[model samples]
Target: MSNKHTTLRKPVLLTSLPLGVMSFLLPIYSKKLGMNAVEITGLFSILSLILIITRPIIGKFTDSFGRKPILIVSCILFAASYFIFSIATTSVLIYAARIFQGIATATMTISTYSIISDTTKENNFSKAFGRIHSYKSTGSLYGCIIASIILSFMTFTQGWKMLFLIFSILSIYSVIEVIKNIPESKKIVTVKCDINKNKSRNTMKLLIIVFMTCISSSILGPVFMIYMQDKFTNNILLLAYAFFPALISESLLSKRIGAFSDKCGYRYSMIFGILICAIISIITPSANSILILAILWILSTLGGVLYNVSEKNIYTDMIGESCVGVMYSIYSIVCDFGLMIGPLVGGILYDNVSHQAPFYLSGFFMVIVAILILILIKKDSICRVD
Candidate 1:
């Protein structure tokens, strides 16, 4: 492993922990606060919209002021958001917390991604990202286990509040780690001419691919949890169990899968990943029991990990070395645009149309995205990092 990658692992893991803890429970917590499907998913839409607006600004800052400072700001914002979430009772307060998280996400994702792309070699992209995501998934797994243990002893309200408080403290610690341990990325100047010449058209293609894929994933975002709540046990621990094995497996497999992508080529791995997710999404609504659903969820998550590792590799290939921060933020904007649309439509469809509408739509769209990837992305289309 590279020295820079080694330096980044702990902070990356620290950053992902809070997100993992929040992923399964946030919808339930929002529901407890009187949010319906629309409202619960609307919070995500609001966050994505904020990301679209702020990411470019954060990107510019990342390029100019350096990555470490932006990351520190992002960690502080994450801490603040969790603190607000711990105390929130109203939807307004929830929205406020999500807004803070949105900005944090904008800063955190762009800077971290840029730093990785800047430091890692192009051919090693998948392996490096895989190893990093392994740490991230491990952190998330720990968060899920910890949150489940806390919930096992307390009422839902109390458990969620305590979880957010714990998340806040973790984020604060992450901030200190960033300040003291993480090193700044060295600027890349050698490849500017090549990057400037070829980046535009390929960048557009990548953005479209990302936007559609985001829609595919987010189409069932809040609605899936709502369905689980209605049909299965409302116990958060059970939900955590459904994810626990999957998280462990994904964490363990990330590096191996990344290495596989590096050797076997990105196209087939990405296509297969997308198809697996599509198949699982299509089959999920038909699950008759929690066990069956957990099995399917595990498959879906593994598929997602496959797609994500390859996708990040492709995305890093597209990034201009000289402006990794700004380019990545632009990429994130496209992702958030799709994310903003998918959840709103999914929630509306679930409420007014049918519960299965979002699932089927999500599956169908993923298949289309997979086909698009097969056609649009090619070996020569991807630029190498210098």
Candidate 2:
């Protein structure tokens, strides 16, 4: 990587790390605060809904103004939101904190992604995106390990508050890193209203494909750990262990998949990913053996990495420089929608039906997404050419 790439990487890594920390700490903390499953789900659902509504406006602002101002403001909001979360005594307060957090999260993520996509070329997207994912995974690993240690030595509530403080400090550091190290992309020209000016049929197709891909990928994200805990005796250690493979595999193998996607085209790469994920989902329910479950978990991670790398690169390629932020925001919205729905649906199915039903449903959805992507590729080939 060049010096410029290195510069961009630092801030991206720093920003990702704190968010990763929050991801692990928040749920555990929520439980400690006496939140029921329904409350927890409702909190996230409201957050997702807020993000879905706000992303496009944030994306538009990033395009019209610049990435730096939006990013800095968002980071500050992110930091302050944690303070509110730390002090929350009621469910309504929790909901309010999450709403602010959601807005900040959406703004920071969309702006940063827009900056990275603008800085990197189409051909280099996979490698860059892979590195980003790796940084994110490393952050998650560190946060989870540190939080676990803290919880072991202290009360859960105390550990949770400490984690929130840590995240707030990290957010401040991320802001500094962005200011000192990451340079603004020289290629991004200020656009007034071009975000909505031109829309190609291919762009619409790409957006639909990206939406489907996100929905399929997020099917198990929120509910999987819960399922594991319920079935395996609610062992936190075991739950953490089950997650290790997915995180580790994605951090290690995503770059290779990204590089492959750059060379082989996003369509083929995503197809392979979706197929593998579908297979894993279909087999996951029948795994009476822990060993098989672990293997499937790793495979699912591999598939997710492939899908992420390819789909992101494709979105950048399709939208190009003009509307990258808006495109990414749209992607985020669809993804969060899926994430919100997945847990609710999974919980209902697990309660009313078999625990295995969620996996089958998830697998079936992936299959549908895979077929949609294939159809998109055919349509694009018939109408557009280089």
TM-score of each: 0.89, 0.89
How many steric overlaps are in each model, in order? 0, 0
lDDT of 1 at 327: 78
Which candidate number maximizes lDDT? 1
CA RMSD of all predictions: 3.4, 3.5
Tens digit of lDDT per residue, candidate 1, span 1-386? 37777777766776677678776678778998888988886776677789999998998899878899998998899889989999999999999999999998889888888788877877788888888888888988877777768888999899888988888888899888888878888484765434355457766887798899998899887688778888787786677677677889888898888877777677777888999999998988889998898788778988888788888898788664767777777788888888878887888989999999899999999999999898888853243333
Model 1, 345: alpha-carbon shift in Å? 3.1
Q: After superposition, how far is residue 212 of candidate 1 from its true place, in Å?
A: 1.1
Worst 10 residues of 1 by lDDT: 377-386
Worst 10 residues of 2 by lDDT: 377-386
Residue 318 displacement (Å), model 1: 2.3
Q: Which stretches of candidate 1 lie over 4 Å from their true place?
A: 27-41, 89-92, 188-199, 234-236, 351-353, 380-386
